[model samples]
Target: MKVQKFIASNMIEAMKKIRQELGENAVILNSKQISTARMFGLLKKKQIEVIAAVEPQPKMKDVRVKEKRKPLSRTEKKPNVRNQSLTSSVYPADEKELNNQIEELKDMVQKLSEHSSPDEYKYYPIPVQTFLDHLRKQGINGMIMGEINAKLLNDWRSENREKTEQEVYQSGFQHLKELLAGVEYGGSQFQKKFINLVGPTGVGKTTTLAKMAAQAVLEKRKKIAFITTDTYRIAAIEQLKTYSSILNVPVEVVYKREDFQKAIKKFTDYDLVFIDTAGRNYRELQYIEELKKVIDFSQDIETFLTLSLTMKEGDLADIIQSFDDIKVDQFIFTKLDETATYGSMINLIFRNRIGVAYVTDGQDVPDDIQKASAETIVKRLLKGLGV
Candidate 1:
């Protein structure tokens, strides 16, 4: 390896010098900033420092190099050519030792996975289990494939139609359905109540409100009024307004305490009042508490906690813990289009007794959200598809 040090006024200059001297196959090992001072001179700006290396051969292209004066002899003599080398050969270990270390790593991974939160396991169940038995039964790749399928099968079972059936998708689907049995909304039973949407940022509350509103208006023919408290986002009010405009529905924006009271009062004749909330970070319970204070006395309000399917499973508990102060009667999920993996929706649903009411996919108004049925949710979840 050709190791060298390059200094410049800034990062781009330093990187240019490294590449120009070391050629395209350069690796950055470290970086630091050092001040330049002269004995007589007062001071100079801090110089950008870089440590770089070039492999034996020219292994990369499309590289930007700095201008460094080369020795006249270098123009006559060709640059030495050799195979590219990295840190790979610096600490070569015995094959047996490598195997033992690998085994140890696999064990550690499996143990970490076992102690993983229900949410942790939800997102990476198969991959976590696969690392443990990689050498025992099949190659690592084979282990990965098998474990992933097993995980998918289990997820599908949660949403399956029949609980007893052994079919892969059916079983996973069934499991999901059973997990959501608690908060399942039996339509028309409480058609005359207020449903609230609350969750961390970017979980699609406004869109969900439109979905429920559309269902109530078009399908149930129930008089629906949309209410929103999300006035933070620069275009938040406009987004909800857009949804309302397309749906041919009325939307009420409530900023102060009085506005909220008035909206609820205005919607008294409506069958359903779908309330959209701002997505906040779960860690900020103060805002949540403030929100609770804002809407605490609302009559017959059923609050739903919305979460993103793309979030890692481990964060779910943190989310629940943060939102605990606020009353969550049910849960809603949005951004299903962003996730390829279905994590612990079942675990959360079952453990929290929160049934999913709607799922929002895209940004399309009144089109992205859907009523989550046990059968459909199960079928898609088993396929490892986001619903």
Candidate 2:
């Protein structure tokens, strides 16, 4: 038997090399992953190694005799004792093991061919791998990563274009921008009279609301007022009051639906009325129901769900789902500086089909808060990656 070893970036390619060099009948003896060229133990590259062997052709007479063998009847005795010794010699224990290994390798090849054919990402270029690692660090969802890899590879191959590393990076950035298209990002126009901020506790909902109010009053020169349904939290109410005092905007503390209506009437002449709701443990259904009792969602209002970028993606997804019945129109991500990964925001935006209105990196009132946009978000996601 002739034995040879093959290596490639992935299993599919390794098999291809094996078949090309050793002929179609080559048997894969073993396969494993390996890493090579370690640079200061940081930049090792991954590779796949496959061990293959091609057996020598047996005599035609022996092949024909083996093919002609038939099953013995119950009345027939076992093979002749003399033939048994010859048979044992012809098929030794080691040969039997090798044949079993060959059968297993054949199965592996079959399965790989069925699943990995037409897979372009099996040979991802260095640039693509670098970007992929950066995204993985940003906590981007695995499914999204897979999707980007597949689409990027397909496009790269179909275009038949020789793109430089910079070009590849730009293409990835552009693809992200396309995914975030049709999303409304920025300060609320307040086309509707009421703009409501809602979310769980400590997500900086009150602070974000304050930032929005500041933008509307100082930059847009619009008459604005505050109506908060967060009477449950004295600190929240007090916080809004402080912002209200600073902006010289009138704020009404509402406890019930009637109180909310009265507050709206009181701020009827204002250009914008920002409503803040009490943060609750949204995992409980009663809190959402209590929200319906205290806030009037029936009014012409745009509700922005405030979320923290530091929150885990699973928890963030659960929080958004908890408000599914509440008609959340958009999102406002806060605490951007607390976490390096901004992938949670992107995941929320795409999965919820909602756009981001604002993002706050710190507690510097309006200065920390900026109008969210695709360009800004993608930059945050790829910030330190040098992509």
Candidate 3:
């Protein structure tokens, strides 16, 4: 057997080196991540070490012919069917070992393909790689992941030694905080009299509006009323009415611009007026036009684009783009507890240059909602990542 060891900056390079030196038939005996001392031992650079071996070819001179023997009878070959069945039911130990090795190699290749730029992440420490994997599983986009990789690599190179999982998480948190620095967060400041909630169908806009209104009435001790333009759904109107009844706040249902104007006039004496727009297919431009006609956007109003975290990233992006004509002040991410992945929220915020006002976890009136902030968002995103 020909045995050789190969070392490279990543698994791909290591596999290439092994194949080139030991041929395709070579078997991987062992592989592991290793750190090499660098910069006069002040820092360490990560590398992959792989050991492989290939069976040696037999020499022609060593070949010898065997004497011919009589063939076995048919009866002899047909015997022991029970033994054959028993053997077929159980895999041989050697074959099982080979299958395990193949699976391991498959997993390595899968990990390589997961990265958008594998070369860029080649030298990342184990903890950093694990952190990046966690981010990927959380549905973070490739562009954001690439940016994060660069930041992590820069930090890893500057440090004298390897970073622990917790240290990597802290670094990620700090970088995310920096990314979200300029965007506005937190619940309404009450600076605007009319707080309008708008989004596509089934995003829970009416419920979210009720939550925000509940907070204002119960916590802030502010007078608020509901002006719902979601007249398309009788249930939505009733749902708002139910919430309004509980809060002892009045609700005005509007079907047209004149009715909306009258509702605005009626709520003029109130501290805040929550406008719940009809949730329709945002892909249709007419819904937005209808919304414009109903709601006085020119008034002292803050428009919030409510979204469900359970939706796909592509769908969320499309919904955000569909509202390009309207002036969206911030976002309200709903159903936070419905999905384990939260990266879509970060992706949208980073791409659209918008911030979150609130995140709703459940159906509870106000308890499920929380005011969004950079710290709170980053912590939620990095949850269960060894933090």
- How does each model score on TM-score? 0.54, 0.70, 0.72
Pick the lDDT winner: 3
Per-residue lDDT tens digits for candidate 3, residues 115-209, read 45343343356778778878887888888887787678667766778887788889988998888789899999999999999999998898899
C-alpha lDDT of residue 202 in model 3:
94
lDDT of 2: 0.79
Which runs in model 3 stand beyond 4 Å of their true positions?
A: 1-123
Query: Positional deviation of 9 in candidate 3, in angstroms?
Result: 13
Candidate 1: tens digits of C-alpha lDDT, residues 1-387: 567888865554565677678775565655666678866668655665777655453223312132243475845965433542532323234534654654565455445456333321222334332222321122213333334444443443345243322343343344446545556743223443787878888777767777677767787788777888887885878987887787677888887778888998887888888888877786667886768766744578777788888886668768887877666766777787887554456556656766677777897755777767656555545553222
lDDT of each: 0.61, 0.79, 0.82
What does the lDDT come to for candidate 3? 0.82
Residue 315 lDDT in candidate 2:
81
What is the lDDT for 150 in model 2? 57
Ranking of predictions according to lDDT: 3, 2, 1
Instruction: Write model 2 residue lDDT over 1-387, tens digit each, in one string.
Output: 789989886655676787788887886677666778777888877676878899765675675467545599999877666656654546656766877777777787566444232223323556666676677767777667766765565555555565776777777788888888886888788799899998888999888888888988888899999998888889988999999999998999988988988888888788899999888888777899999988888898899989887777888888888898998877999898898778888777877789988889999888998888988899889877565
Query: For each candidate, how many residue pairs have backbone atoms clashing (under 3 Å)?
Result: 21, 0, 0
lDDT of 2 at 75: 97
